[model samples]
Target: MSHPLVIAYHLVWTVYGSWLPNDPRGSGSRTVRFDPLADLGDIHLGRKRVQPPRREVREFYDHAADLLKHPVLDLDKAARAIVGAALGEVVAAERYTCYACAVMPDHVHLLVRKHRHTAEEMVTTLAAASRAGLVEAGCRDPAHPTWTAGVGWRGFLEHPEDVRRTIGYIERNPLSLRLPVQRWPFVVPYDDWPLHAGHSPNSPYVKRLRAAGRYP
Candidate 1:
């Protein structure tokens, strides 16, 4: 997709060693860069939610977890808040427009509107800020790498439907993982985008914000 066509981006990345190339859920990777993980099949899978592999197979992937350089990141509430606050600062400083954001246990998802910056640049900046927050709070080691190695998923959204759908998906991610509904202060509501007028002001997130007394 061209830069101009993109109204927003679905930026996703895993914490270090959390999602291997051969995860039970589908992955964007084609190769298992780690030698121990290579023995497991590297099925070239799309990112869509599919019938997850068998439970045993899912548990089997952990056998190779020892090979990873750093522990998988399972962010608690405090860690999530730290990252969220740091992300809010980046959004404000860079003049980024965030339509949705979810800080998951093992990864993060953000839907940011088109800005003077590129999607990759936003991802990099946001990740750096999160790392700094963790380090400053003494949650992560100063030298520890926070995110997974290699390419993170970047799906560009050109249409309002795409933006709406992604917003829903990001919001439901935590619930699907059996985690509480995450409410981040950094996420702004997606009220009919000026460039594309069909976006709904009454998104699930909007309702959530209203329920929590967090919206205006």
Candidate 2:
């Protein structure tokens, strides 16, 4: 059966002060911010949501830029295009089957199969390729870092349903923000997975997944 993956990463620009390690929602690391919420005691309650400290919201905004190595990144059309192209090249070179991707102005979402590389390696390579592409396009500043210091968020997709849901979410993210639909040349057809109507399903990849009972 094809391994499913759903990887979501926010750019350094998007996370600046909005969602720091100190966020009351819980943090990924201590270096990002001094999370006072971590001091409040056990916040994990199974699947329940943890509320952030109301005061730290303002604190995060105050020190957002100070925490970043570069100024906030607001990608223009050219920048997004460069990153998208670079992402496609990396995917093809790595031999991972890409299902969906959304290269938002400040972040990116990807749904792919875990192939020869681990998810962490995939994301790191993608970040590096994207940075190089930005540099080539003259969109990246030489004086500052292109991406955030640490690796962005990573999650595993355990089921075909998860894969389908995640892809839909990624595809519809721009619309959810009231932005225009994101169409890019790098978005390859995901023949291995179930697609909305009108997409052909005549690939060997789809046949394998179907034989494995991974897709309907």
Candidate 3:
């Protein structure tokens, strides 16, 4: 028998305009302007390569890690509302069934079913609309970039077991890490998390999984 057609997608929603500075080696420049952290002074008397300043190095690494870890949205109540509304629109347009969703200060995690959209396409739509939504929600600050360039993680699930594992990982990921924690903000709490809208929560796909006794 031919294998069934099933696909799963796990996407991460990063904070708006909160990307960390990276090494510029690939940007045509041979070196970074001034990495205080990496620039350790040498032993002047001996002109020897002494141990670099640990504190500076540590600070720089810590700072960069924090920045790249997650985004922190500094939106007021009204702005959040707008962002939420806009996100709803994007989700609807994409036709993804969100199993679990968490909105963190700096990022988001969405356990959604793969629709007619690709991971890249979903991210593009979300990033664009979310930014516009922020502005619509009254964040008119020209300095704010609205969103980072792309998503952090986009996992494609090909098996029933993988889907179960991915969902568990996404839900507990926040507790497993530090701040910019994502909170369950918009998962369809009552529909058993179907893949498509209007499909019976117990669609044929799900039945087949159960029949196979592999519905993780």
Local distance difference test, per candidate? Answer: 0.78, 0.62, 0.56
Q: Is candidate 1 or candidate 2 better by TM-score?
A: 1
lDDT of 2: 0.62
Residue lDDT tens for model 2, 17-113: 3344544465455453335434433333222275557685566545555655457666677887788899889877877677778777667787776
Better of 1 and 3 by lDDT: 1
Order of candidates by TM-score, top first? 1, 2, 3
Kindly report which residue stretches of model 1 are placed more than 4 angstroms away from their true locations once superposed: 1-4, 48-50, 195-216
Error of 1 at 6 (Å): 1.3
What local lDDT score does residue 153 receive in model 1, on the 0 to 100 scale? 88
**Model 2 CA deviation exceeding 4 Å by range:** 1-19, 30-59, 191-216
**Candidates 1 and 3, the one with greater TM-score:** 1
lDDT of 1 by residue, 27-123 (tens): 7888777677776665557754665667755575577566677677688889988988999999989988888889987899999998888888888
lDDT of 2 at 21: 53
lDDT of 3: 0.56
Residue 212 Cα positional deviation in candidate 2, in Å, after optimal superposition: 14
> What does the lDDT read for residue 193 in candidate 3?
39
